[model samples]
Target chain A: MSQKQEPRRKPGRPKAGTDQPDARDAILDQAEFCFAAAGFAGASLRDIATRAGVNQALLRYYFGSKQDLFDAVFRRRGGMISGRRHVLLDRALAEAEPTVETLVRAYLRPQWEMKQSGPGGAAFIALQARVHAEPEAHALDLRREVYDPSLKRYIDALSGLLPAIPRDLVATRMAFLVGAYLFMLNDLGRLADLSEGQIREIPPDDMLEQLVRFLSAGLLAPAI
Target chain B: MSQKQEPRRKPGRPKAGTDQPDARDAILDQAEFCFAAAGFAGASLRDIATRAGVNQALLRYYFGSKQDLFDAVFRRRGGMISGRRHVLLDRALAEAEPTVETLVRAYLRPQWEMKQSGPGGAAFIALQARVHAEPEAHALDLRREVYDPSLKRYIDALSGLLPAIPRDLVATRMAFLVGAYLFMLNDLGRLADLSEGQIREIPPDDMLEQLVRFLSAGLLAPAI
Candidate 1:
């Protein structure tokens, strides 16, 4: 929770020559931490500003309001993850025949990689899981805007592979896949405790393989 | 969020014989709602008291502290769900050979029935999902205490069925099954949106069937 090390400026004012990009990034990062720790309704602008070593006025200037700031935090990482998903999907489709496993891997790997990338990425993973629990007013638009199109692409690709399964069932299973992956991403030591340290350390690649295999089987299950 | 009406009393005082059990149940219900909407760090005792139509002092008198109240909320429904799971498991094991589907259904149906039971049950489902996203200090003990024993029973049963899969891998897939079921439990309109009205309404029984099928396939997948 340490603030960035730099010379302090007036609390409400951003100097014209200051690195505005750094300030904005810092605000989003701290906002993600706060929003993830306490949910959207619980996180305060003052707390986020203080954690970022900036002032509330600067946050307002950069992001307009708390809601706007939340949307920004989501868009910053949600957009990036969605973008990566599309790229992965493109390469998978271009490289070889897209089996359910290939499509599942393509959809899941980007988020897995992002979660392992750094603290900020991990915070976003937690925040994304929290988003599903949020009230519709707060979460619906953000979800539709940030994730729907990319998710639709994956769902369609999955449908293409499982032609016997209805598209709606495919969509339903896609939602299940998301739940499984998000839980694994923010497991918070459940696996270690559950396994009693027997499987304490799973390499990221192997973990991803397990997820893909489980989900691929699920997505390919016969329609009932 | 309307408070239940019987008769208004002094804000800070509980009547000597005014249905103490009812008051305690009311407090647990509203507390579940608040904690589900706001994370443990974000939910306030004052808000919960107000929502329950009691005062903060009564909450303190009954539950000791906010953490204690949270644990109570979890234990109330969590204990019930786990209890139901054990019953189902017993019946499954005695009535027939415990196939993966039967074990999966035994583990999953209790929570599904609870979610479909009433608003109080649904609130607890949301609260349970939010529990995983909570910090370790808030979530760890409750999860281990309320859920681990029943979950371990199911994991062992599944391992007994799938002798080829390692026990730790079985544990990991159990975690995945939890995530999938929880997400499906609190889908929050994602399925309708994802399906674009094509599958707007699914019967609860059918939804549970789909979940059981998906997870059975996942849990029974060949070890990677």
Candidate 2:
């Protein structure tokens, strides 16, 4: 997790004098871990700085406040996840005959891939789940800025595909989908306990396929 | 949010000399509010004590520890929710021809009703969501004790209803259903933001019906 060593500087330390991108990334990485492990209020900035191997001043220099640091951690991966979703959504929509399954897959695949990306990816997934559980005042702005656009696009596509359902109902179910995906993303071992060792670990592909199938059926359910 | 007044005691205060159930209930109430707002680690024992109009000693006397208090708060409502689910489930099973929708409604209705019960109900919903997002060590035991039995019953019932699907897959989908319900229970205002006021507040009955439709379809989807 440390960058290359520099002459006259310790390992995990960026250049002391100027603001370096490596230092910024390190802080975000550690911040993500801390926030994922503990929530926003529970996570300590000083601890994040220590884990990142930078001083508190450097953390402040890079990110103004604890809230700013939290936002930065979210924005870094939140943007990437949303961007990938858009790319996948565009590709799916461009298909010769886009089905609800294809669109659902497109919406879910990016997050599935992100969870599989690496430790950083996994940490971000946990952090994102925590953000959803966070109080509205703390999470609302970041969610609106980062996730709402791509989510709206998916909601629109799903509505178009299921014309029988009211658009508002579609929107509500989309929220349900978001909830299911986020919960499944980091189930916190509930699945294992609930299944009682009957289902230990599902292969990533199968899990994604299962989710798409379930949600597609859900989206196409006859409107009430 | 306070109990009845007592002679020579403050309004929020309980009988000081004894371990009154009222004092215990008050502690749990305030603890639920604090934990819901600030999370387990971030919630201060001091604040909870002050809010409940008892000293820290009384909290420790009744609950023994902070973790104990958290568990008690969860168990208080978790047992009620799970017990109500069982009653509904049993009723559905007793029906002459219970459909997938009926079973789904049975499982979800308790939680929906709990969310509407009052402020305490709302706070428990929030706390439950936070518990799912909490670190596993902190939440796992409480969840297993309070929720797993009813969840397992639902999984078995669903598997019996959809015999072609793998039992494990049914369990997985049940987890998905749980995720969707918890998320929609207190969506952290996501639906409002996503719908952009096209849908303001969904009437409770409509919301439950919509959830039943979505989840029933999701659960009955063909096994992958």
Candidate 3:
């Protein structure tokens, strides 16, 4: 599948230059849209190529296969989000005493900010929600590849803030926090409809503060 | 679209009898599996009919159309869950002071119970998660038909319990609670994987208690 010796390679196309990386980025962009809209099983490579305005040959050459392309799209944004979380966590750690609120904010704020990162960010958030409902195999794959390590780091931070809480309970609370965050992010509009437009009126920053308080309390709740 | 005068109706079937309702139930069972496995757009009427062991004509005779069938599947369970919530809330209200814990447990425990009811219960929960990731039009349709009224009733009860919390914040916290519950239910296995087998050890009843405690704390968190 390597394109190194393939005769199909176009000559004189600005060899190893700016446009080559742009092409890869464009393919990832369209793939993110397709995968987000249709999911891993439903998205078609042909349709993705057509949407990206690239030929199928070049698409495969760049990303190798459909699953590989999906991983690439997932990693592209997943890596960015993970990087942001680390920076936020570092800032929280520098505080005199990083309370549960600071750690919770560190975990939640980067994702909230993702909503403002433009259409790609929004698409990725939607895609992550869809990924949750994916079949067990794909869900496990993403969990291992993208989510597990980053989640562990955050959970460790949460546990560090609440040493008296049992480690397992700390993990459970963190899991609950993530579930709430992802679910709310995807269902913000539905919440609006259910709450008579009241939820929609709360600005994102205010919502984040509300979430931090709610989650911090949950994490610090007395053991049952 | 009316089937009132269709020759497709099979005679000799006991009219207004036990066998008639069984056929509708069978179709719904199959449709739930298909929709949960493949989503609304991915699942087809023909496949559902085949899996149900009924003719396509009979399927249409019972359910009218694809969208109508989806709505029926949604309403079948949505109605039952709503009914259970009403019962739980009524009982909780009978107490001298229904703690936030009681109200939150009333809202959450029934859905957890559904997971053990049968295959239908599990499928409906999965379908509900998938529905959150569906197109806005379909998600909105479900919110209007099944979710909005029931959620409002529960939120009102929670607000009544926590009178000091602003009404809008009450709704927001309830929204967060539902998000967390749905996300956790769908990702139980993922949680196990992320927590390195720690989460898998918690029994369902224990998990429910943990969820109730976490959510009750969230609901009662002081308004930011």
Candidate 4:
């Protein structure tokens, strides 16, 4: 191997500010698909490299390792989604009285907007769903750092809104809300077979409306 | 290789019967874990064989191919769960004036029972969630055959109960219900991290009760 191709660099510091913006985006895009489809353990750097049309060395030059690449792919999209959610939640909390419906909309509306953010947005949603559903904490460190804070805020906001509901119940409902939203938005198309043609016919906004409606009801429901 | 070890078999058919029940069960159990963790494309027979404490050839000898083995693992638990769901729904239908609570309980109670059906049961729930969330039709054939029938039954029953709710809305709610239930039942512990000890305290029965209560509300909530 030539020294030019495989330049030894410090670990954890990928060559920053790429001259070729598309190259970096291309690598991340392919990595997103791979990691979404196969997962962190299942996805291989070689496959991602080949798909991105970059050599393995170049791939590592851009991203230190597979784990780092996975983190990069996660962060590229996670920052956008979580950042938007934080803003929405902040706006809702500033209101004098934030109802569960408003909070639910704040938490869920970004997912609908993400559906319009093109393939990268959808891929990120799928990747998030996979990582969220993962049993092992493969992506736990990043998740805790990047996303959990926003979730905690929402959980706290909802807990205060529904004092009649137990605090634990708020957290549980939040988990359920996220679980249902991610599943519905990410793999909701798979339900086409189940719905014959009905699920496919509903517009994205309508789908989000129904999801918000369902989640709000569950959140506001009285304990038996 | 000796005839006993390297038995030439057809691609689709493994040996008719297994002399060792434990080995087969062990193989299915390990396969369930690997497939759930890594997915079909990501999981390898070698890893499964190693985990099962069996040789790769012996593993193939029993299950034909990795796909066949995946199918076996899926069917082993899926059939039981779907079958029990069918029976429960049947019993609920037989009851006089089966309320939404009755139907919801019938649909969800089995999942709690499944939690006690050993590791295989838990693994199956995770596997089902993985397969359900998967967008690709990797194992769509089996899923369609095993799951859609019971889901249709539940949807129809729910539609009847909520005559005011649109049929398509019932389908959407069913999707959300399954998504939430599967996530809650399968990886509910993952939330303990998010809840920071609050979610950890809820007893399993209370958890199920909360789930049932939440789902019942969502199912019965008036469409806006």
Residue runs of model 2 more than 4 Å from their true location after superposition = A1-21, A188-190, B1-21, B188-190
> Tens digits of per-residue lDDT for model 2 on B150-182?
999988888889999887888889888988999
For candidate 3, list the clashing residue pairs, or say none: none
For model 3 chain B, where is the 10-residue window of minimal lDDT? B6-15
Q: How well is candidate 4 docked (DockQ)?
A: 0.52
Candidate 2 clashing pairs? none
DockQ values per model: 0.64, 0.64, 0.49, 0.52
Interface RMSD of each: 1.7, 1.5, 1.7, 1.8
Error of 4 at A220 (Å): 0.6
For each candidate in turn, the TM-score is 0.91, 0.90, 0.87, 0.88
Instruction: Report the alpha-carbon TM-score of model 3 versus the true structure.
Output: 0.87
Candidate 2 chain B superposition, TM-score: 0.88
- What C-alpha lDDT values do all the predictions have? 0.85, 0.85, 0.80, 0.81
Ranking by TM-score: 1, 2, 4, 3
Candidate 4 accuracy as lDDT? 0.81
- Write candidate 4's Cα lDDT for A111-200 as tens digits: 778877888788788888777666666656777777888888899888888889877778888888877887898756676766655545
Local accuracy of candidate 3 as per-residue lDDT tens digits, A29-64: 999988887777678889998888678777789889
In candidate 2, what are the lDDT values of residues A1-224, reduced to their tens digit?
68866554454654567665587889999999999888888789889988987787888888898989989999999999999999998998998889999988898888888888999999899889888887767686788789999988998988888889877888888888988999888873457766665555777578778888998899999987
lDDT (10s digit) by residue, model 4, range B1-224:
65676554344534658454577888998999888777777688899988987778888888898778988998887888789999999999998899887888888877778877888777778778777766666656778888889888998998888999877778888889887888888667677877765546787788888888888888888877
